[model samples]
Target: MKHLFLTLATITTLLLLLSTPPTTTAANAADNIVYDVIGEPLQAGQAYYMVPYDYSDVGGGGLTWLQKTKVTCAPYYVSQENVNTNFGQKIAFYPQTPGQTDITLSSILNIVFSSFTPPINCPGTSNVWSVAADPATRLNFIELRGSRGTRDLRTWFTIEDVDQGGYKISYCPRNRRVDCGSLGIVSRDFGRWLGVNGTNPLTFVFESEEFFLNKALGTKSYAA
Candidate 1:
């Protein structure tokens, strides 16, 4: 697959937002958070290609959420579509349960992603901070499962944030196979790959549930 690769000159759009995230208020329980891999917004209702920090198609070739499952993969994006609850299914991801999908800290972040979309230049507008949590336990988690026989393998991540410089934060690991935690933070001084050129800071934002629901539904954009 082809993850949209933005050259230094093309990322002006994201850079502008990144530089301004500092003005945004700290995330509260009831806010829609923005998260992304490589500084792109995970657009709602849009199926997108996803990859781990370890993998790269820097030259413009890589796997996506639509490909064979791996330790980390996703065509993950936000949507009003009811999140898949059937654990038996191939894939699922959501920030909160339907009934209590409140944009509050108490709800707990829950995101379940299953599926793959190959590499392409990743868009700067489709990155989103999906706060996946259990409907019952309300425990924070980021479930990363493989396909079929390997699907049972998973990891849980607790969401945390930073506001000083861009949207700095990590999914701090709760469970998984190898080198878990730090929930994949790679920035100023953390994460799996350090100081790679063209990589984005693992940062994000939280917004009101109502705010994002509308954005997902096409009733709004990030301007609100």
Candidate 2:
């Protein structure tokens, strides 16, 4: 009887352990996670990409800064699209544009992602995707470098679209100089946008993070 009871207890314990979900540590949780908004209110039609800015080496000029990038959208969905990545793991984004008279920024601007071909030798590269807007702004701010020990990149962005009578003004903040070879970044205001009325300037901001995973290409992983 004693042996049977011990055996049952051991089996139950093993089953429980197997059924239990994996718990992510606080530090690991910070990696590969998405942050909605920080520092300012996110406008409806504006979107921001939180590109990671890693500054570890002065001689190399912080090669990790190259991983930073930006993608803008009018509505929130469009921003989500910018975050979407598939097997190849390329980064893509949309541009900002003026909203129609009847449509507000909240309705016109949104994040959407489609298939793309990334640059050569860049894992998860993307192709020439469409912007879906005219007179819009698009730019690359930084580049990523070799992997660190579970240390993912982090960055933030904001988008704003304010009504200025006959037209609308949109602005996205970008870094001016990005050293891909050395993976260094120079902090300069590369603010860009379209439909500026010269009077009322609308602004919005959003933040996001990018993690460099070691998983094999085309493998799927989820953060629950």
Candidate 3:
């Protein structure tokens, strides 16, 4: 009888240990805080792409060379139709290329949008934001506000896992109410990957609860 009781206790203890969540190290804890904010890690071996549209200079009229005249510029505006019609998907990264590397635990990819067709009307003009993948398992973070400018727009996205089949994504933004509003469109499909790499680039897709048009613009238009 005693032997049977001991055996049951041992099994219970083992099961409890196995069921517990893995303990996160200090570095991992910090990374979790970051990943909790962003969506997932941008892997090295994988490829990424983005397409941006600026309507600042879409409309313009100048005089001929013979007759130099100072002419007023026409007001340019970018509508949803213009974005959907004119902009074609652009690849931000191509893994098959020479320099492309599979995203590992310790890798960082930074993409900045500087020039605007009409100049980004956002509050801060000069600034740099980045998506950083640290040396942690399936973890990534994004720093929206950098040393360049300050206009209260900050957020992040993460790539949690990537393999032969597909990938997973997550989005967490600071000041959700305000930042979410400014992000525009692409924000809607945050935690989903339409398609990683296949026949068509424009087919890339994602799904999430907090969807925004600007976020979609960034993903579909910028990171197509």
Among these predictions, the greatest lDDT belongs to 1
Alpha-carbon local distance difference test for all models: 0.32, 0.27, 0.29
How much is the lDDT of residue 94 in candidate 3? 18
Give the C-alpha miss distance for residue 42 in model 1, angstroms. 12
Q: What is the descending lDDT order?
A: 1, 3, 2
**Cα distance off (Å), candidate 3, residue 206:** 8.1
Model 1 clash tally, residue pairs: 49
- Regions of candidate 1 where Cα sits further than 4 Å from its true position: 1-99, 105-108, 113-153, 165-169, 173-201, 205-224
Q: Per-residue alpha-carbon lDDT of model 2 for 1-224, expressed as tens digits?
A: 99999999999999999988766664454332223333233333232332222112211110111121343311111111111231212232332344322222322222222232234555522222112222232323222211212212112221223232111213232432321111112332331111222211223222322222322333434221
Residue-by-residue lDDT tens digits, candidate 3, 66-125 = 101223332211111223233322112212224544332222233232322222543332
Per-model TM-score, in order, reads 0.29, 0.23, 0.25
Task: List all candidate RMSDs to the true structure.
Answer: 21.3, 19.7, 16.7
lDDT (10s digit) by residue, model 1, range 1-224 = 13455565468777887788553465442254444433334333333222222222121211212211233434342221112111111222243334442222222333333343424553321222333443453333332222222212232223444444223224343353233333322222111221111143333333334544565578866531
Question: Count of backbone clashes for each model?
Answer: 49, 38, 44
Task: Report the C-alpha displacement of residue 118, candidate 1, in angstroms.
Answer: 13
